[model samples]
Target chain A: MPLVDSVLAQYFEDALKRADAMAPDYALLWQSLQAATYGGKRLRPALVLSAYAGLGGPDPAEAAEVAAAFELLHTALVLHDDVIDRDFKRRGVPNLAGAYRSRAAGRGVPLEEAAHRGQSAAVIAGDLALTGAYRLVAASDLPGELRLRLLEELDAAVFASAGGEQLDVEFSLPGRRPSLQEVLQMSRLKTAVYSFEAPLRAGALLAGAAGREVEAVGTAGRYIGTAYQLVDDLLGMFGDEELTGKSNVGDLAEGKCTPLIAYARLCPEWQELAGLLGGTPSAAEVRRARNLLEECGARGYVEDLVECYAARARAVLAEAALPAALLAELDGLLERAVQRSR
Target chain B: MPLVDSVLAQYFEDALKRADAMAPDYALLWQSLQAATYGGKRLRPALVLSAYAGLGGPDPAEAAEVAAAFELLHTALVLHDDVIDRDFKRRGVPNLAGAYRSRAAGRGVPLEEAAHRGQSAAVIAGDLALTGAYRLVAASDLPGELRLRLLEELDAAVFASAGGEQLDVEFSLPGRRPSLQEVLQMSRLKTAVYSFEAPLRAGALLAGAAGREVEAVGTAGRYIGTAYQLVDDLLGMFGDEELTGKSNVGDLAEGKCTPLIAYARLCPEWQELAGLLGGTPSAAEVRRARNLLEECGARGYVEDLVECYAARARAVLAEAALPAALLAELDGLLERAVQRSR
Candidate 1:
């Protein structure tokens, strides 16, 4: 296994142990947290550790904690994001809200009451995870100045993410579809920076990397992060639901102003596509929409965009004055990310 | 005007400037924020600056920023809390959610959609305020260690606040009347600590006060905070809406499990009180319930409790090794706080 992969595995194990220690009751909250933490691919954490190592960060164990903090934060975001998006399933299983609703129903609460209870519980759980994320970072033995800077970065990313979410929600309204540039800007703010750039830059900052070396990591992160989000957009519309562990074409139903949608809007024939967006759509309608997107060459356009970002990421990595081995590993990861089917 | 009051005023102006600078074009968000920030009584900031001066802290300007940060955080909390509580009015004006809802309705959205949009906007707005609070603290010229410790305390208080909210929500359910001790615990965690103790202690910390000095503020803060909460509880039950700037009897309608309710639950004729406690009582029912509370001596009992806390606060202030003038000012504030009808 690559060094970053090993670091990530170790970090995951340690994070689970820390979470267990923090919530000893092993109550429903802990159980739901464990399920959420273990469900996703550890892409964000891996990015953090990889960037750390590539920038000469020593001691994988210490770097792992930084990685773990990002994962915990991500888990909190995903849990609360699911609630905001009104999603019922995640990772092919009942999400926190769905599980809590079922538990409340089992206790014989009215359905509406149960749902309210579930949402309330999920909100609190997300908050706990957020606190837990900070505690992890604070407890790390990193230098005080470095830790503070990392924390400040994390805080800024959180605000940016919330801003992007607000814009996304607003853009879902009829006649409110943002421009393609705006959609990409929102995606970069909401996902790319936090998911890839911030964590990576934070890891590098922790390692005392500075000057051009630090700038290099940031540049590389931007490219990789943008590519990661473009791939995610493609997956949302085209990937297998069974493998992605989320609803395929659900973004279309939700009228998400993704790059694909933005590209489709450019075609005269796709003007009617706007009416089909928003609210839940049937499987057949989703299929028809998918065909429409393909007919407009939107899917191909997004794929080309993803590849362009991927190549940019590789070029940045190559130009960076890091270890060749580490750069190669990151290059391989970027290639896999863009090419992955699920 | 008192020195601390002037200092805090300047800080509020600066903090508002900083927040405005961060988002110049976000007119709706900024307008709503201005309304929320300017609506409150500025009690929390007053307490923080007062406590800092009482402890003989230097640089009241820096102390004022710390104070303003706490108040900003409190504003954020109130905005979100109103949404959670489904409150329509605050300080005799439509709150952020209500105002947003009205705007949405004016734009021709359905009532329910308008309500949801209002809520979503409020949530995001509150989030921005919360982030703005931390930004204020982080950007302050305080000592690094003190800033870090203050940030940690703020983070912990946020977690406690969220936990307390969950407990409050849980206690509202049928057959779950918590004990008076539990109510106090929740109050301390949710309101007292964050509203008074943490901010005061943080101000002291930023001033480079010794541990003993900080501990003294904490001791005094506990009593003052308890008394403050007691007054809040009383205001919820009996204060005039115009004076208090809150809806009369709304707490009772929302089934708030306050100390007053806990005391009422202890009466021998508690069954009648219980029936009237959590329900939306009519005007006659509210009058009768008020009569029952007075007849059962619950009101007097809570008043005596407030007096006891007030006395303890004075004693702690005397015991603390601080300037006599500052102590006298704090003492005067505590007495006025207890005496305030609202």
Candidate 2:
């Protein structure tokens, strides 16, 4: 196995053990936590570790705990995000709310009451996961100043992401279409910085990287994160459900105003597409909307944007004063992130 | 002004400035923040600074930022708590939700949408306050280890408080009334520890106090906190509205399962009170319920509990090895905290 993979496996084992020990009686909370944590692609942790390696840091084992911390935080966000978005499934399985609702029904509660209870439980579970992330970082063997800095970065990312979520929720309302630039800015703050830049910067900071090296890693992270989110937006619209393990049409169903949707709005044929985009559109309407997106060249436009970001990511990586081997690995990850089917 | 008050006033000014600079465009967010912070009695920050001084530590100014941090965190909790309770008013003024609801109406939005937008904004505002608390602590001049410890304490308090809140919410539902002991435990975790112990301990830790001294302060804090909560219960049931700034009969009307209510549940003669307190009751019904509480000796029972905790607080203060002058002030503060009308 690769170094990052080996370290991540051990990290997950330890994290799961710690989570289990935290709540012995809350069996459902434990199970939901395991489901959220165990199946992730580990992109955030890999970014952190890669940044550390790029900064001349040795021993992937040393970065494993921090990696675990970032992953725990991400999982916590996902669980809460699903609840906030009213998502019923993730990775083709019942999400936390769905699982808890089912459990409550088995105990003979009314449906609405069961779902309310599930939401309440999910909120606390997310809080516990968030606290666990901090606990992991606090309990790490890292130096105190470094730990504090890492925590500060984590805190900033959380706040920014939360603000982004607020904007995303607001954009769902009528007459509130944000400008495309605003959308990209929100995406960068909400997804790119936390999902990519902050974690990588945190890892590099932990490895004592300073000045231009740190700045370069952050730049690389931003490019890669933008590309990753662009791909995610594309997949949300057009990916196969069997492969992506998502609703495939979920974002459209939710009326999410992604970059592709925003571009579609700018086209001359937007009036037709807009009718099919928002509210409860039929399956046929959704198919037509997807077809409209392709007809208007939105899909191609977004794909081109993703490629541009991916190329920018490569250029940034090339400019970073890091080891050739680490640079190559990071370049590969960026390409794979933007090109992956699922 | 007393040393603790002087320090807190200065700290509050600086912290507010920092918060303003962080996000200038979010004016309503800042106003809600100022309302929550400035409306508080400054008891928590007083406890912290006083504890630092009680430990014979000089330079109380050094603890100012952290004192402000605790106050900010406490305010954030209050904002969220008000929302969770669907409270329209707090501290005799419109709450964040109420204010935002009015603003949305002024903007010509529909009622339901406005209310939801208000709730969403309040959530984001509370989150911002929560994040601001950590930022203050992290950027303080305190030593890194001390700062980390303080942050950890605050985080743990938040988790415990959230857990307690969950329990409180659950207890409000039919068929889920926990035992009186469990209620007290929840109260201690939710209100006492964070509101009293953590702040004091944070101060002591920052002032270079030893473990034993910190523990002793915690003991004193627990006693004071419990007594304070007991008094709060008393105020909720029987205090005059003008003095308490809350409906004297509000708890009874809302079917709040507080300590007094729990004690009433155990008494056969108080069965009438239970029926009245089962759900939303009329103002007249609330008045009659209050009379029943007094008549059935539930009020007297709570009074006795308050006295016991207050005496325990005084005894703990006497036992703590601290400067005599600081001890005297803390004792006076504890007495006033329980004895004050509002």
Candidate 3:
């Protein structure tokens, strides 16, 4: 883990060595970004390494740049995710954009323009990290063909995510909701593949793993990623805000098309809270929305979905006959991924 | 030109063929995007093909896909440019983001939230186009090494542009302003390299041109691109809305970091007007701001700067000793690039 941290740190120092040459403020932005990633879980990077090591490859150290690439990509997604979701906080603090917004406000910029500037800054920040993700892959010291394939994989994942994102926007519109099955499909396309499948496969591919092993890891990724998102949706409804590093009512306020929301739409009893789903729902309204989710069986439905997918993921890992220790690591991963739901 | 158009059209058809399969609304968004590119100047695509043919390439037809890639890259940059500038119009019409915002507003969505949604949609639209640009290159019929180098060139240009953009934001801050030298550097980094250098060098690179020739084209592109941006900045302040398809007052209202603004910061008489730059200046204030720009000789200063870069670009073209026809074509290109200044 410290090796991962050191690799990321070195990437920042070298990749952004030109930042100071470009401009001091630009350097400051990159410095702040480096700081932001330092204290985080590095989950995506871990997946990349674990998948690499599990597939009978070279040392995990050789996979470091690829791991760093995914971490940067995840950072890009989270930054833009806040812009789309219009949330201001991350990890109980003003996020990257929010920090800039507060800075402008402190400087007496008109509130509207300050907010606009903040969002604009974040967009550029995400763009920087997004392209930096590709640059790292190019710098990965991997074979050229493998590097190209990694880019291709990353592209497919982003393409799927962009599609899912557009669908998400459409579903938020009145009378324009996707079906529950569509929601599940969107969740897989939106979150599962990119969050799980892409990193796992990239790591496997880099290790020169067998096709069967690569395919097996991808299948495992799909199931685990689906479970991960389902649990996340449940947490959005009921998890402690402090624990999740998110507002408990964000999904309700943003009208996110989570599986639970999809199921809630099927229940007549949930109609009243549906109006509050995307609006500025108060704490009391969120509590009532929670009750509606409980009464209408949406919560139970989501929990069952999570369990089903988690079980499928476990089954895939067992049948693949990966190292027993690797299987145990994956088991721990699955448990850690879903345990937040409670 | 028609070949380039057909290539782009076919790409949209096939690439987005699966969009409707992903989500109908996703298909609609791509449809809107395709329409958005239809009426543009096609200058970047032209540069790609022109540079290819001028370099003694066997055929311009082979360059079509790469040409289309540049157009998409331009489109991606412009979409985000609107979001950053908070500009509502493009070519005298509601820009892509503005149109979406209008639609949301028409649906009785609250004005502020609708605006936020519109910007969010634009962010995703840009992201889609950005990734689609890379996908086209991967899908190009060019040799592998050439394609890879093209990506490297593109990566550098985008990296420079991002730095320029961040610097642009920093300079727009009230207490922060770039020197005249910094403004010129930012203009080249922000616009010229991406707009002119990358596309031109891409065409030549695809034609198997040599390193010296390729580097010369980049130098020419810098002069031309900076000149083009200077002319554009002037148009933003002084050109007729009917002629430019943009209000003359937009630069003042947006508080852009144009060379003119850079000069105005030096004039004591322009101090009060500078405060009105980024705010909602009234018509009378805009008129006064214009007067101050002229009175303080900032407008003349920018015109001279444009002429300087334009002449420099012509010199680079002549010195490069490309074919006479290529030089003449570049002469025509240079004229076309900055003619709006008159």
Number of the top lDDT candidate: 3
- Residue-level lDDT of model 2, residues B135-164, one tens digit each, is 667656676677678877777577667666
| lDDT of all predictions | 0.72, 0.72, 0.80
For candidate 2, give the lDDT of residue B87: 71
> What's model 2's overall lDDT?
0.72
Residue pairs with colliding backbones in model 1 are: none
Candidate 3 per-residue lDDT over residues B1-342, each given as its tens digit: 988888888878975887877877778778877866775789889998988999988988888888887888788878887888776678777777887788778877778777776777788888777766666775566776787788777776777777787778777776776898888888887889888999999988988988888988878988888889999898888888887777788778778888898899899866686677876889889888888899999999999988898899888888888888888888888888778778
For each candidate, give the TM-score of chain B. Answer: 0.89, 0.89, 0.95
The two-chain DockQ for each candidate, comma-separated, is 0.26, 0.24, 0.53
Poorest stretch of ten by lDDT in candidate 3 chain B: B131-140
User: How many pairs of residues in model 1 come into backbone collision?
Assistant: 0
Interface C-alpha RMSD after superposing true interface residues, each candidate, one decimal: 4.2, 4.2, 2.0
- Candidate 3: TM-score? 0.93
* Per-model TM-score versus the true fold: 0.87, 0.87, 0.93
Q: Which stretches of model 2 miss by more than 4 angstroms?
A: A1-35, A92-94, A97-117, A135-141, B1-35, B101-110, B269-274
After superposing candidate 3 on the true structure, give the runs of residues whose Cα lies further than 4 Å from its correct spot. A1-7, A138-145, A275-284, B138-145, B275-285
Question: C-alpha displacement of B181 in model 2, angstroms?
Answer: 0.3
